[model samples]
Target chain A: MPINYYIILSLTLFVIGIVGVLTRRNTIIVFMCIEIMLNAVNLLLVAFSKMHHINQVATNPTAGTEAQLFVFFIMVVAAAEVSVGLAIIVMLFRNTHSIDVNFLNRLKH
Target chain B: MTIIQILFWLLSALVLLSAIMVVINRHPVYSVIWLIITFFGISGHYILLNAQFLAVVNIIVYAGAIMVLFLFVIMLMNLNKDMEPQKSKWLKLVGAIACGCLLLVLIAALKDIDINNQIAETNTGNIGLIENLGTVLFTKYVIPFEISSILFLSAMIGAVVIGKKD
Candidate 1:
C-alpha cells in the first residue's frame, strides 16, 4: 500500500475524532476523541518517517526517526493525562451523578 | 496478497472498528473494553512499522496501566448504561458537517503528496535495539528527556492533589 494511504486513513480518523469531541456530551467519550486525535497524528508522523527513510532524503535515519520518538513521548504523556482526566470525571460523577456537560449548570454565572 | 500486507490490512481494520465502537457504545464498561482493543490494534500497527519498542510501550502504558485506571474509575463510580444522555440531533448535524469539511480539506491538501512508494531501507539487522534507543535517550536528547520526566512527575503530583479527599 502507498504511504499516502496511511495519511488518508489518519485524516479520516482525525475527522471522526473531531466529530466525536464536538458532539459527544459524555466526558469519557470526549476524552477518547482526544486520544483518537493523538493517535492519528502519531500514524501520520510515522508515515512521514517512512517517507523520509525510503526516499533517502535524510542522511540519518536516527534523526528522521525523531518523529517516532516524539510520538512515544506523546503516548506517555497521553497515558498520564487520561488517567488524571478519568479520575476527575469520576469525581464529578460522584457529586453530580451525571456526565453530560450541558447539565453542568452549577458553574454557570 | 502477501502475508505481511494482509496482516497490516487486518490490523488496521480491527483498529478502526474498535475505535468506532468506543464512540458509539452506550455502556462505559463496554466502551472501555473497546478502547483496550483499540490499544492492541495500535500496538500492532507499531509492530508493522518495525518499532518493536514503541509497540511494547504502547501495550504497557495504554493497555496495561492506563486502562487499569480507567476500569478502576468506571467500577468505583458504578456507572450505569442508562445514565448516558442522548445528544441532540442538531449537535450531531453540526459535528458531522464540521468533521466532513475538515476531512475534505485534508484530502484535498494531500492529493499531490506521494510518499513511501518504496519501502524504507531499514537496518532490520539492529532494528533500533533497546541499546540504541537508550543511547539516544541518555546522550543526545538527555536534557529534554529528563525534563519530560520532571514534567510527568509534576503531573502526577497535580493529579494526587486534585484527587485528594474533599
Candidate 2:
C-alpha cells in the first residue's frame, strides 16, 4: 500500500466531513461530522507513523510512536469535547426546543 | 496485490460509504449507526497496519463509549423525528462547492509530498504494542497524559454545571 492510498482515503473522509459540517442543520449532526474529521486525521497520522517506522534504520528506532501518542491525546480531547458539546447541545434543546443551529443566533439578544 | 491490500481497499470503501451515509442520513440515530460502522472500518485498517493496540482502543473508546454517548443524547433529547429543518439550497450548494475546492487543494498539496520512497510493510517494531506504548506514555508523554486528566476533570464539571437546571 503506497502512502498515497492512505492520504487519499483520509482526504476523502475529511472532505465528506467538511460537507456535513457546512450543510447540516442539526447541531448533533454537525458535531458528529467533526468527529469524522478527527477520525480522518487519526487515520492519516497512523498511516504516516507506519511509514516512518518502516523507513527508520538508525534514528529513534521507535519513530512514529509519537504519532500514536498524539492520537491518544486526540482521543482524550475528543472525549472531553463530546461531554461538553453534548451538554451544551442538551441545554440548547432545553431552552429552544429545537437543535437547529440557526436558533443559536437568538442567543445574542 | 496481497490480502492486506485487498483488505485495505475493502475497509476504506466501507469507511467512506458509511461516513457518507452518516452525513446524508436525516435521523440522528441512523447517523450514529453509520458512524459506528465507520469506526469499525477504521479499526480494521488499524489492524491491517499492525496497530493492534490502537485497533482495540479505537473500538473501545470510539465505537463503544463515544457512540453510546451520542445515542444516549439523541434518545434523551427525543430528537427521533425528522425535525431538523433543511438548510437553504444556496447554503448546501455553497457547502458542496467549498468542500470540492478543499479536496482539490488537499490532493494537489499531497501530490508534492515525497512519501512514496518508503516501503510499506509489516516491519513496524514494538511501537504499536501495549508494553512499548505504555512505557513511552508513562515515561516521555507523562505530562501530556496528566494534562489530559485535568481536561477530563474540567469537562466533567462543565457538563454537570451546564446540565443542572437553572
Candidate 3:
C-alpha cells in the first residue's frame, strides 16, 4: 500500500487539530484536539514503519514491530493523559462552571 | 490508481474531512462523534499498512477507551454557563495563519517523495505476530516498558491530588 494517503491524511488531521487547539475557547475541544494530534502522529508512524518493512529490508518480522511497540506506549500514555486531564477538566469545571480554555488565563503577570 | 489505492484515497479523504469537522463543529457531542469517525478511518489506514495488531489496538484504546472518557467529560460538564469564553476575531486570524504556515511546511517536505514510484509488498495480518512483538519489547525496550508503568502511576496520583477539592 502506498503510504502517501496515510501521510497526507495524518498531516491534515494534525494541522486541523493544532488549529482547534489554538482557536477553540472550550477546554474540552482543546483536549480533543490534543487527542486528534496524537492519533495523527500514531497513524503516520505506523505507516512509515510498515513501509520500511515492505521495502529494502526483508521484513525481519522481529525488528519491524518497533513501531507497533511505540504505538502501545502511545496508548498507555494517552490513557493516563485522559484520566488526569479529564480529572483536571472536571475540577476546573466545578470551580469555574465553564469549559472555556481562554478564561484560564490566570498567568497574566 | 488501482482498486486498493482508490479505496485508500477514499478513506483518507473521509478521515481528513471528519477531522476538520471535529474542530469546526459547534456542538460538543457532534465534535466528539466526528473524532470517532476519524479514528475509524485511521484504523483503515492501519489495515492498509499491514499492521493488524496495531489497527485493533488503535481502535480499542483510541476509538473505544479514550473516546468514551472524552464523551464522559463532555456530559459531566455543563455547557450553559456565563464563563464560557468566546473566540475573538484576532485569535481566529492568528490560528488560521499558523495552520497555513504548517500546511506549507508539510507540502514542502513531502514533495521529494513520489509514493507511486515505490512498489510496496502485500503483507497483511502477519507483521505483529505475538512472539515477534513480545521478544522485541521484552529485550530492546525493557527500560521504557518498566518506566511507563511508573509514569501511569504518577499520573494516577496527580489526578487524585489535583482533583481533590479542599
Candidate 4:
C-alpha cells in the first residue's frame, strides 16, 4: 500500500522489459517488451497520482487527474506507435522473410 | 496486512511472473498470452489505486485492443518456434547483467525516499470519474488531445503506405 511498494514493483517490471528488449531476437517480441515498459510507467504514474490526490485533497482537487490524463495520452501514442511499428515490421518480414531485428542492419546497402 | 495489501501483493507477483514468462517463452504465441496476463495484473493494480476508469481503460486498450493487434500480427506472420532464430548466449548474458545493474542502481537511488504509510482506498471519489477526466481533458489538456489525434492520423497513413505491397 505504501508508495515505495508500487515504485519497486513497477521498477522491477521495467527492468524485465529492458532485458526482453535487449535479449530478444524477434522484432515483434521487442515491441511487446516496449509495451511492457510503457505499462510499468503507467502503473507508477497512477500510484503517484493517487498518493498526491490523497495528500492534497483539500488544497487541489484535480492535482492527481493530470497523471491519469497523461496515461491516456500515453495509451493513444502507444496505439499509434504500434500501428506504424507493426506495419514496418511486416514490411521487413515480407522482404527478408525474417523478423529478426539484427537482420535489419543489412538494409543499409 | 489488510485485504487491499494482500490483493496488491498477489497482483504484483502475477505481473512479475507473467512478464518473465513473456520474455523467456520459446514460442511467440505463448509470449503474447503471458503479456496479456501481465496487462491484466497491471489493470488490477490500477483498480487497487482507486483509479477505476484507468483500470477499465487499461483492460480495453492494452488487453483488448492492443493485444489483439499483436496476436493478429503474430498469426499473420505464420511464426513458429523453430523459425525463431536464437540470439547468442553472450548477448543474453550481457543483457541480464545490464538489466541487473540498472535495477540495482534504481533500487539504491530510491532507498532514501521515505514514503509514509498512506494506503490507497477503493473509493477516492470524483477525481478519477469519467466526468472529471473529460472536463479536465477537453478544457485544460485540449491541445495535447488534438495533437494526439493528428499523431494517430499520420500513423494510420504511414501504416497503409508501408504495409501496401510493392
Which 10 consecutive residues of model 4 chain B have the lowest summed lDDT?
A: B116-125
Candidate 1: regions farther than 4 A off: A105-108, B114-128
TM-score of each: 0.90, 0.95, 0.89, 0.95
**On a 0 to 1 TM-score scale, where does candidate 4 land against the true structure?**
0.95
Ranking by lDDT: 2, 4, 3, 1
What are the candidates' C-alpha RMSDs? 2.4, 1.5, 2.5, 1.6
Of the two candidates 1 and 4, the one with more favorable DockQ, higher being better, is: 4
Q: Write the per-residue lDDT of candidate 2 for residues B1-166, one digit (tens) a residue.
A: 8777788889989999999999989999999999999999999988888888888999999999999999999999988655889998998999999999999998999887777555555534677888878999999989989988999999999999999999
lDDT of 3 by residue, A1-109 (tens): 6566566677888899899998888888888899989988988777767666766366354445788898879988989989998998899888877676667777685
- Specify the CAPRI tier of model 1: medium
Clashing pairs in 2: none
Off by over 4 Å in 2: A107-109, B122-124
The lDDT of each candidate is 0.75, 0.89, 0.80, 0.89
lDDT of 3 by residue, B3-80 (tens): 778878888888888988988887888888999999898888777767777778888988888889888877767454
Positional deviation of residue A69's Cα in model 3 after best superposition, in angstroms: 0.9
Residue B143 of model 2 has an lDDT of 92
Q: Which stretches of candidate 4 lie over 4 Å from their true place?
A: A107-109, B114-123
